[model samples]
Target: MIDRADFLARFGGVFEHSPFIAERALDVGAVALPLTAAGVHAALVAVFRKASEAEQLGVLRAHPDLAGRLAIAGELTEDSRNEQAGAGLDRLSPAEHARFTELNTAYTEKFGFPFIIAVKGLTKDDILAAFEARIGNTATAEFETAKTQVERIALLRLTAALPGE
Candidate 1:
C-alpha cells in the first residue's frame, strides 16, 4: 500500500497534459493513493506498455459510447458522471441531436468504435461539432484520434486516482 501522501504524488505522472481534465477529476486519488496507484511500476507500465494487436484495437473501442451512459460505481462519484451523461449527444435540440446521431452512427460504422471526446468541460453543441468534424477523417486518421483521446482520458482518470507519477 502506498502511503496516502505518496500515492497522490504519482497521479501527476498519469496526466502530463491538459488542464480541462484536471478540472473535471476529483482529488480523491490523492487521499486514497496507496490503494489507488497501488501497483507501482506494473500499473504505470500497463499504461505505457505494448499490447497484442487485438488488444490494441480493443483499446480503441474501449471508450464509453457517445450517447451511451457512463459506467456507475462507488469508486467514482455519481454526480460528476451524471453531469457527463447529461452532456450526451441525444439530449441536444432536435436538429443538432439529429446531426449528432447521424454523425455518431456513421462514425461508429466507419471506425468500428464509438466516437470519443473528453467531453468533460465541453458543451453538448461543442461535442457534437467535434464529432461532426472528426467523422470526415479517414479510418486511419480517426483511429489515431480515438487512440489519443482515450490515452488522455486514462491519464485524466489515473491522475484523479493515483498518487506520484
Candidate 2:
C-alpha cells in the first residue's frame, strides 16, 4: 500500500484546490494497494459526491474562472493553467477576453460559482458556447452539471498523473 502522505502528495490536487477529497478517501479506506488512476478517481469522486451541499459548493467555488483574472494574473494551479492553455484560453484576443469576462461574471452571478469544465479536449469557441448554453440552466441543474464537470476534470487529471494504469 502507498503511504498515506505519499498518496495525498501525488493525488490531492486531482480535485482542483480541494485536497480534502483525497484525505477523506484515505480516511474511508479507499486507497488500497495496486492503485490505478480509475480506482483512485472513483474513490475521490465518491467522497466528493458524499460531501455536504455546502462543502460541495465550496469545492465548486474554489475553481478559478476560465480565462479570467487568475489566468491573466498567472495564478491558476498548474493543472488548471495547463488545461486552459491547452484549450487556447491563454491566447485570447481582447474581444474574446472581454466576452469571457462578461460571461464569467454573469455565470457566477447566476450560479454562485465559477464556470467549470474539463477543458482538456475542448477549443476556446467550444468552451464559450458551452458557457453560454449552460448559463441559461436552472440553479439546481447548473449545480449538478458543475459537479459532474468537476468529476470529469478530476478523472482526466488522475489519468495524466497515473498514465498506463
Candidate 3:
C-alpha cells in the first residue's frame, strides 16, 4: 500500500489549493495500492463529485483567476504557474492583460467562480476566446462547466505528476 503521507504529498495539490480532496479520498478508502494516474484521478474526482455543492464551490473559488492578480503578483501555486506559463499567459500584452482582467471580473460576477480552462495546450488567444464564449452561459450551466474544467485540470495534474498513465 502507498503510504498516506506520500500519496497526499504527491497528489494534494492536484485540485489546485484543495488538498482536502486528497485527505477525504484517503479517509473514505478511495485510494488503493499500485496507484496509476488514472486510478488516482478517478479516486480524487469521485471524492470531489461527492462533495456538497457548497464544498464544490469552495474548491472552484480556490483557483486563481487566469492572468489576474495572482498570476501577475507571482502568487499562483507551482502547478498553476507552470500551466499558465506554458499557455503563454505569462506573456500577455497590456491590452490583453486588461481584457483578461475585465473578462475575469465579468465571468466571476456572473458565475460566482473564476473562469477555468485547462491551459496546458491552449494559447492565450484560445483561452481568451473560451473565456469570452463561456461568459454568456447561464449560471447553472457555467457552474457545471467550471466543475468539469476543474476535473480536467486535476486529471492533467495527475498525468503530469504520475507520467505514463
Candidate 4:
C-alpha cells in the first residue's frame, strides 16, 4: 500500500534485526501494494525459506537468548524486550535466572545455537520446558526447529507492527 521505502522502515526489524528479507520481498515484488501484515509475513517467510543455510543460521543467531545476556544488560531490542518481559523473563528470581543460564549454556553447547522459542504469551516455565526438551534434538533437526521458531517470532512482531494480524 505504502511506498517501498516506508514499508521497509516499518517492517525492517520484523525478522529480528534483519531487513534483507523485507527488501528482497519488495525487490522481487513478492509483496505488492495494499500491504497487509499477513501478506508481508508470507512474503518474508518465502524469502527465509530460500535463504542459504549460513544466512538462515545468521538470522537465528541474531536473536537474543531469553533472559540471557542481552536481557540482563538491558540491550535487547524493544520488541525483544517487550516479548521477554511479557513472558516474565525480565523478572526472574536468582534461582530461576541461574537455571535459565545453565540451560542456555547447555543448549547452545549442544546445538551450536541459542535456545529459541516464540515467547509471546508463554510463561517462563513454558520456555524452560521447551529449552530442556529441545536441547536433545539432533543438530540438523534443531536447526530446522530454530528456523521455525524464528518465523513464529517474526510473525508475532509483524502482527504487532503492521495493521492486522
Q: Write the per-residue lDDT of candidate 3 for residues 1-165, one digit (tens) a residue.
A: 778898889989899788999999999999887788898989999999999999999999999999999988899999999999999999999999999999999998888889999998999999999999999899999999999999999988888777445
Task: Using lDDT, give the best candidate's number.
Answer: 2
Query: How many collisions between residues are there in candidate 1?
Result: 11
Off by over 4 Å in 1: 1-49, 69-83, 86-91, 163-165
Candidate 1 per-residue lDDT, tens place, 43-128, comes to: 44344334454555665554455554343232322423543565664355667656666776788888898887766667887887
lDDT of each: 0.55, 0.93, 0.91, 0.88
Error of 4 at 84 (Å): 0.1
CA displacement after TM-score superposition, residue 17 of candidate 3 (Å): 1.1
Deviation from truth (RMSD, Å), model 2: 0.9
Worst 10 residues of 2 by lDDT: 156-165
Sliding window of 10 residues with minimal summed lDDT for model 1:
15-24
TM value for model 3:
0.97
Q: Pick the candidate with the highest TM-score.
A: 2
Q: Residue 165, candidate 4: how far off, in angstroms?
A: 7.4
In order, what is each prediction's RMSD in angstroms?
Answer: 8.8, 0.9, 0.9, 1.3
Q: TM-score of each candidate?
A: 0.59, 0.97, 0.97, 0.95
> What is the alpha-carbon lDDT of model 4 when measured against the actual structure?
0.88
